[model samples]
Target: MATMPRLLFLVPVLVGLAAPPALAQSEPFRVVNRTTAPALALHAVRSGRGDWGGNLLNRGPLAPGAFFALRPSEGAGCSFDLRLVLQDGQEIVRRNTDICTDRTVVMTLSGAARPVVPAPDGKPTPLPAPAAATARPGVAPGARPNPQARASTGTGFVVGPDQVLTNHHVVEGCSRIFVRAADGRTLPVPQAPASDARRDLALVRAPGNPGPALAFRANPVRRGESVVTYGFPLAGLLSSGPTLTTGEVSALSGLADNQTQFQISAPVQQGNSGGPLLDRQGNVVGVIVSKLNAARIAQRTGDIPQNVNFAVKGTEALDFLRRNGVQPVLRESPGEERSAAEVGEQVHPSTVFIRCER
Candidate 1:
């Protein structure tokens, strides 16, 4: 028989995601299914490599709320990509999963719905576009609200000498705008900011020379292409440094065919509003904007939305910069792909945390 691509198993629905309990090296990894449907099969392959292992479940179906332990290979890396098959024939694919770090793979309904095949080379495999969901009548679309009630924070990146770019709402109605670099140097915006409320982008100038400018890709971003972003989301709750998230271009347009934005699957929080969304080659492609209001959507549809986030397209941002007399840099062509961590290292110097004081 042909070698199975990887270990096969399944997890059921999990309501909320939390850090899993760590197990000793000798212990096996656990998978918890809390989904509505029974998991038919589960398979996994080491991220960035292609090879199959024996079934983690020993060829048994994973029922809802059921748990199982998967022993690790004798000498394998920590991260792996997962593929879970449900009884309804729908599947889910999650990439760069660190089984040891997470410990338990608690599957959610919406998270386990998107079916994708893992590419052997770590590239995104193309899938047909999913049909847009119709909203309930009279339910308004509220993009995740900016939490700038008193003093709020967001993220920005350097595009030109002494110039930083972020969302308009981040600095809107603020008495002061301050930025903190990765090295813990905090500086205030000295000059008036160039604002474009229509596009939800703002360019501010702070003291000191920037390390290096981030470049936008010359070519357009394709749907299903892998993307990464760096930002300081959830300012006080999370780390003082930038956090990185990776996903794929889920759609070419934002909600309701808004061409100015791109829908991405990379998770973003409130403070991510103005972060840079980069392609696999470390080129700017979009500005982290807003995520669909899951609470509102869940209230209306009874199903929670997952990773339904939006970003301002880099083309529009570049245009905004030029219209305001700032020349944004652009890469000549596409290059070899690199890991998200490598891209974040180069982006660290350009990205900063912005605090808006009203």
Candidate 2:
């Protein structure tokens, strides 16, 4: 799983200012869907109240290039909350409202908002290289098995000695989970109590292994900091033990749920969830949760930005694990945690290529 880079615009300043003293002026704007598909039954929701006050039902599906004007009542001008809600119950809320006058509120319904092309500098930037097979101190290397022979492979991390972290959906209904270490060892994951699905996380204990204590960091990460993600994507078609992807923190606290989480530009695929999102200092900052997919919105005729991935904040996960009585083997200091490049160098042999039957 590699991190993808994304470009986002800052909310206009006028959207956040206090309304004029006079009650005669009201905010005005337009809503537009700029994707290839139409947005079904879109509605504007007022912020804070969780209610839709405007009743401009898009009679026909809003085609890719179609837009509708939103006007405020006469003699009533103030900052108003607005959002786009689809018939399928998906919603995209705007954090700011700058409706001082007529404006073209163009919305991108599908596909990723275009990335900012880097300036053409001849200097070569180091792209993340593929994982190489190298043994870490005290950890042995493992062999690679045929990927096609496996039924399914789920990505996870060693949270404690002989303990792993993953998503319940990744191992749901499985009688046993195969645990692969970075040193090329494979062990069975024993049944462990799982947390509620509202958080979408799970924990498993490695079988018969008192492995090394894992490292953790609790500091909140600021947006635009360098981040590296590690996971087995596509069931190991990519390297088996922690494929590393690099990107920056795109956003924080912008999700629909308004939860404090990281919006990383990491390139992830199916089987990449439950992996660690590490900061530049090699400390775990968050857990990879979901990848942004534009095709799904296309199918539903709804608008959503693509390449937007979400992570569960590490602090939240740590709290959840503590509340659930799952104790992680935490390292004492920064010197104890291995760097991403160092971990990448030594983790190949300890991981196994998992193949499962459907």
Candidate 3:
């Protein structure tokens, strides 16, 4: 490597869970995949309001040229922001389009790379995420947040009944921690959370059922294997509901060849830290941790990097949970891969958007 990319910084980010099974993955409009690449996920949130309702194509990915017909919901409004994540981790968004007036939305890949298949490769109901959160200098590993008046938001997944997992930065310096499930419920964190800032992880205990806990993957992630990220990224700007992105394990080490962390190409923005990184089988492989500081790197190198994010390894998260005396669900990779939408449905009830108020 000619020059080392310096920073692997952590920040707050999040996503909402999906409606329970009372509702299915069907939405109110038709989405046609007119691209050569398979679509890993599709989401439609009511244009300017509402979290991402659910993965519209939860049953499976939309094969190239396949069209999914959504019968209009009785009360879901007409306008929506339709986002599609392709297998190569490219997102094509059709924003604020009326599903009622334009009943069919056709999508085509926007000339992003369609690579050869590499071997690997939300929700709870939600409360409206804070209209905004205050940002500050990030906390260093094992360092507590300085007492302040700003709140940070991050994503967390259920590791067990009533146990939500997230990054310590999301909880540092907060007067209180609140978790929003997919079902429009706001859960209060009753006790002080168990945290390991060294690993950048925290476990918050909230009351009520958290649906099925996500299973951690039994094997190590392979370089170039496809992975999916589910979190609430840019909720203040994008939909607060679960946002999904797909990409491959770019490398097996982090900045400075950190073994406890891994490099991924999945796009993660502020408010996404602490979310789960899943394999094609919906097994939790890592925790969405941080991304390179692009502007700083750009100034140093005269070029900017894109989608260079990192995650804490699943084994590290598992160790943290066990140290906290929480038993987590674990699973081996199944023979088949699931569409990102399917993973969202299976784990939606288990994922929560975390908001920490200082």
Highest lDDT: give the candidate number. Answer: 1
TM-score comparison, 1 vs 3, better candidate: 3
Per-residue C-alpha lDDT of model 1 across residues 1-358, encoded as one tens digit per residue: 1122333332212111111123443235666666777776676666545544444445568888886666655434445666666776566555555564456776665633664455799533436524332111121122222354346678889999888999876765455667777677777676557877667888888776544678888897889989998998877778877899999999999987989999989998878878999998888999988788676567658999899888999999999999888898888545578989889998989998887654
RMSD of 2: 20.0
Per residue, candidate 2 scores C-alpha lDDT tens digits across 1-358 of 1111121222221111111122233334567766565555444533234455533553556656777665555422233455554433334443233344225555653322222222368322223322221111121223333344324555676666556666644543333356666666666544433643445566666654524544567555678877777777764254544577778788885356547467778767666677777776666777777665455445456675656777777777787678767675443334344556865543333223222221
Candidate achieving the largest TM-score: 3
Q: Estimate the TM-score for candidate 2.
A: 0.51
Residue 53 in candidate 3, Cα distance off native in Å:
50
Give candidates' CA RMSD values in order.
Answer: 17.7, 20.0, 22.1
Candidate 1, poorest ten consecutive residues by summed lDDT: 11-20
Q: What lDDT would candidate 2 get against the real structure?
A: 0.52
Give the candidate order by descending TM-score: 3, 1, 2
What is the per-residue lDDT of model 3 for residues 1-358, given as tens digits with 9 covering 90 to 100? 0111111112212121211112322244577888877887777665544455556666678888887765544344344566676775555655545454345787765432223333333312222322222332332323333335344577889999889999865675455667888786777776667777667788888776655688999977789988999888765668979888999899988876889988999888877888999999999999988888776577668898887889999999999899888998888897688998898788788888877654
Pairs that collide in candidate 1 are 5-52, 6-52, 8-42, 9-42, 12-33, 12-34, 12-35, 13-34, 13-35
Model 2, poorest ten-residue lDDT window? 12-21
Q: Pick the winner on TM-score between candidates 2 and 3.
A: 3
